[model samples]
Target: MKLNHSVTGQDQGLPIMLVHGLFGQGRNLGAIARRLSEQRRVILVDQRNHGDSPHDPDHSYAAMAGDLAEVIGAFGGRVDLAGHSMGGKAAMHLALTQPELIRKLAVMDIAPVAYAHSQNHLVDAMAAMDLQGVVRRSEADRRLSEHIHDTGLRAFLLQSLDLKSDPPRWRLNLPALRDWMDRTTGWPEGLPKGIFDGPALFMAGAESDYVDDAGEAAIREYFPQARLLRIKHAGHWMHADAPEAVAETLSAFMGGG
Candidate 1:
């Protein structure tokens, strides 16, 4: 599959790829990439079934990992990788499956263990929107508010909604994503064996339950060199909540500072 991506700082230094979570596109990390662009080549990728990437009914960590591998290969061998939530899991799988293709790995606010399907409400809310009759983004926002309580989350999800001049179209493949919510949330079982010895950083939001004691063993099993860092007062979206901290940590890690 030809993965969709936006490249920044291409001529600066070593390449670093940014992968976003579920319901997120490459641009979600635009800020971080721009900040890091001063010293590194940043590649923000939109994983399959999301953003402008090709949509397929099958969405799994293995498939997503394969997609990432292809992107890395296109970059001329290995590159540093950073991912959040769902993207974090896929990054881990990719590093483990193709260790030689990843220079360094950073996983934000997500564990390697299998996550239970908890985003069903969000999926249902997104699916319930009357896309056909929706006249404006505000109208869609108003209707979505009934099902989604968090105004911020509603706005974040709605970022996928793009209005084209030619008859207006929704860029995201909502139905396909909604139908494979389980696959998107689930973890791949079993590994080929051994660990990815490359330097790895496991960043967790202080207030997020995504990375807890329960998932530590699984993380260590695959990424034995992984080091954990917690950003204060942040939730699942640590990068958005604490951009400065994330940028500092990432810059240091990638630059070997």
Candidate 2:
């Protein structure tokens, strides 16, 4: 399917595949990938329906997992996988569904359980932007500021905007994303029983609500061998917020050091 990816480092070592969160592209993890590249091959993948990948009506973890498997197959099978938020959930699904394709797994700041509908404000803010009349990216930023007060969040969302020869346009499929909002926010149900016994890493931002003390039991249930790491003073985007800490943790886990 020609899934968009950014590869770094030497190709000889164990390949590490990165999957980004909702509203994020492969480039979101570019910094992390570059750092990890020194010792390992890193491939940052843009999940379907999000970045430069093909868009489809299907938005569930099952479909996303399959898409991940396809990408892995293209890479000659077997990879160390790491994901954040929605991508984290998808990585879990991939590990559980296609165990053979994954060497080890890392899920950042997300539990296996279905998340509540808390992203409504973000969705509303994106939808409220008049895409048709948007002449400049700055104007879009101004409009987003009315609904999303956080400048960081507004800037993160606006990264998807790009200029084409004809006119400025949004690379993301906003309408499809909006339609599948519920599916994206929620987790997939009904896994056959039994945990993914392979090595797993569960990383959470200490200040993030995405993973809490109460969620540990469920996370352990699915990933029995999973080791949890917490990055202090970081929010949902821990990898970006604390790249050095995240990189250290990931390197240790990957190397079994």
Candidate 3:
């Protein structure tokens, strides 16, 4: 599947590829991508079934990882990879399955283990919205309030709504995403034990339980060369909540790794 993407920066050295969280487009990480682009080619990608990417029935991590592989093959042979949330999970799967294609891996606010948090309701909430019936963003916002009360979260999800569409369409394949939420939150089944010896950075949000001391054990086991960092005043969406810290850490990894 040809995924939607945008490239920035022309400086030499290894390129950086960034993947965004669920319900987010590649441009979600534009700020960080632009910063890294100053010294390296940065490719911001919109994962399958999201953003402008064509919708597919399957939404497993393996499938998502494969889409990323196809993307890298088109851009370059290998790259420094950074992913957040669901994107982080896809990055881990790609690195573990194809270590040669990745020079270094950076996983933000996610671990190699299955998450206890259930985001299915978020999917359900989005699915419940009748985009065709709504004519204005305010009505959509009001309907969304029935499921989500957080202002920031509503804004995030609403970004996928194509307001100008004749019938008002969603950029995301809601059903596919809803069906795959469990798999997205769960680690791949029967994955090989091959360790990615290449350096990896696992950044956790200070307020997010996505990665904790117990989870670090799994990360270290899968990526023996992995190191952890915690960004202050952030939640599961650290890249959005703490852009400067995330960019600094990513730049350090790209330059030093």
Task: Give the C-alpha lDDT of model 3.
Answer: 0.89
Ranked by TM-score, the better of candidates 2 and 3 is 3
- Candidate 2 residue 41 Cα shift, in angstroms, is 1.1
Q: Candidate 3, which ten residues in sequence have the lowest lDDT sum?
A: 188-197
Ten contiguous residues minimizing lDDT sum, candidate 1: 162-171
Q: Which tens-of-lDDT digit does each residue in 1-257 have in candidate 1?
A: 88999888856545999999988999999888988887888999998878899988777788899999898888887899999998998898888888898888999999877777567777777777666766678887888898998989988998887654243445667777777777677677777535688889999999888888977777777777889999887899988899888888888888831
Model 1, residue pairs in steric clash: none
Highest-TM-score candidate: 3
TM-score of each: 0.93, 0.93, 0.95
Model 1 regions more than 4 Å off: 10-12, 133-135, 165-169
The C-alpha stretches of model 3 lying farther than 4 A from their native spots are 133-135
Comparing 1 with 2 on lDDT, the higher-scoring candidate is: 1
lDDT of 3 by residue, 1-257 (tens): 78899988874677789999899999899889878887888899999999999999999998999999998898667889999989999999999999889999999999889877778888889888767678888898988999899988998999899988888888999889888878888899777654688989999999999898778999888888888999999899888899988899899987932
All-Cα superposition RMSD per candidate: 1.8, 1.9, 1.5
Candidate ranking under TM-score, highest first, comes to 3, 1, 2
Q: What does candidate 1 score on TM?
A: 0.93
> Tens digits of per-residue lDDT for model 2 on 197-244?
788989999989878766677788888887888888778999778888
